[model samples]
Target: RGFFTSNRDGGQGYDDIYKFLETKRLLCEQELYGEITDLETSALLPDAKVSLFDSRFNLVSVTNSDEKGNYSFNVECGKTYNVRAEKIEYTTKEQKVTVDDKRGKTHLPIALEKSTCKVAIGDDLGKCFGIKMIYFDLDKYDIRREAAFDLEKILDVLSQNPTMKLDIRSHTDSRQTFKYNEILSEKRAKSTINWLIKNGVDPSRLTGRGYGETQLVNQCADGVKCSEEEHQLNRRSEFIITGL
Candidate 1:
């Protein structure tokens, strides 16, 4: 017989013990349980996606690690399976297991490595490295101190990847004539490229161009009434990965 404590609708304040008759039981199917962690820090990685694949590399099942970084899966004995764990900003990790009828359960552990680059090649962004849309003071082409600090991130990424090339584009708000803004944006683009060259980056690895106010992010285009913050969104610099 089995027994448990419960508080039913008509029961008293104190919990009462309920009993049940024992019934014939069957053994459960074999299962796999595992944990995922960081390779360097050994910290548990929660919410990581875990996928199970058969010996033929065909996906069998998928699940995510719990908040405690634990995951489980049921399996057929004598079948070989591969498990892959993945999370953003981290390299994916895989492990293989072969289940046996003799074992009722299997334990697997995975350690994922951290990726070097947060933004990959061909990533276009309005902000990065705690800096929002690299912008210059009014009528200025030279790089600002804050912008220089933000550009350092690009330098680091380029230094890490010697073969990578970057394309720089500069834009301006639509406060001035089209030709005026185009010329100012072109100067700003040249200034950015020169700064990179002065910082020891190969000039051959970069190409700078200007689109002026032609590609406004919002309705702050010519004669549009918008706040300074809204206009500021259109006045910015953009970096695009041109080549590997």
Candidate 2:
């Protein structure tokens, strides 16, 4: 009898070859199509580092900026990546880039801003005390653009002194009932607290209290007619340094 290779054995070999060919085809397609562009300004920047990360922020690749402050990297299509740029004396910038199937190349430009001067915790707590309080409109607790700068400064102070504790106090004008004002004030205080927490402030170091119309900074008593500005002064949010 002649020796014969079984059909099963022949079929296994064919399947292995097919898989190998498919993998090679995929590699060739990726090499031909994947592309990316790095955009930067013609400014003298220090050693800037650029990195790409997956959706989970896992570092996929790292590259340094060219002399002209430019960096680039190739990424596969149909993937989402977070691009982060960093330098020593500059604020870190991050952007999200998504490569679409139709668009093979993406241009991502990042501009870095100068970092702000760091303030120490013990620098002068009284510097903020002079600012007095933040007043809100009736039944509203949103921090207006006018107060954003002060809040940013407060955040800076908190960042400088990581161990500092603050009491976020909320007050209201006497025009509203005590019970209603109390609830509104509390909501306002909590809203401000939430903003701070969202901006990276430690929640454990912050506590909130609502004084309603109980603590009046001005002489506008309950029965007295007061101007809008005077009433505003009474309806305020304040932060006090409880612990250092």
In model 1, the clashing pairs are: none
For residues 103-131, write the lDDT of model 1, one tens digit per residue.
48888999988876455567662242232
lDDT by residue for model 2 (1-244), tens = 2233444555766334332123232421111111122224335554577777766656678888776666777677667787766665455556787766553456776776665544344333434433436768877888865455346556655675678888888898888788998988998899889989999998998888898899988888788988989889888888877777
Off by over 4 Å in 1: 1-113, 116-121, 125-132
For candidate 1, give the lDDT of residue 158: 70
Q: In model 2, which range of ten residues has the least summed lDDT?
A: 27-36
Against the true structure, what is each candidate's TM-score?
0.51, 0.49
Query: For each candidate, C-alpha RMSD in Å?
Result: 16.5, 11.8
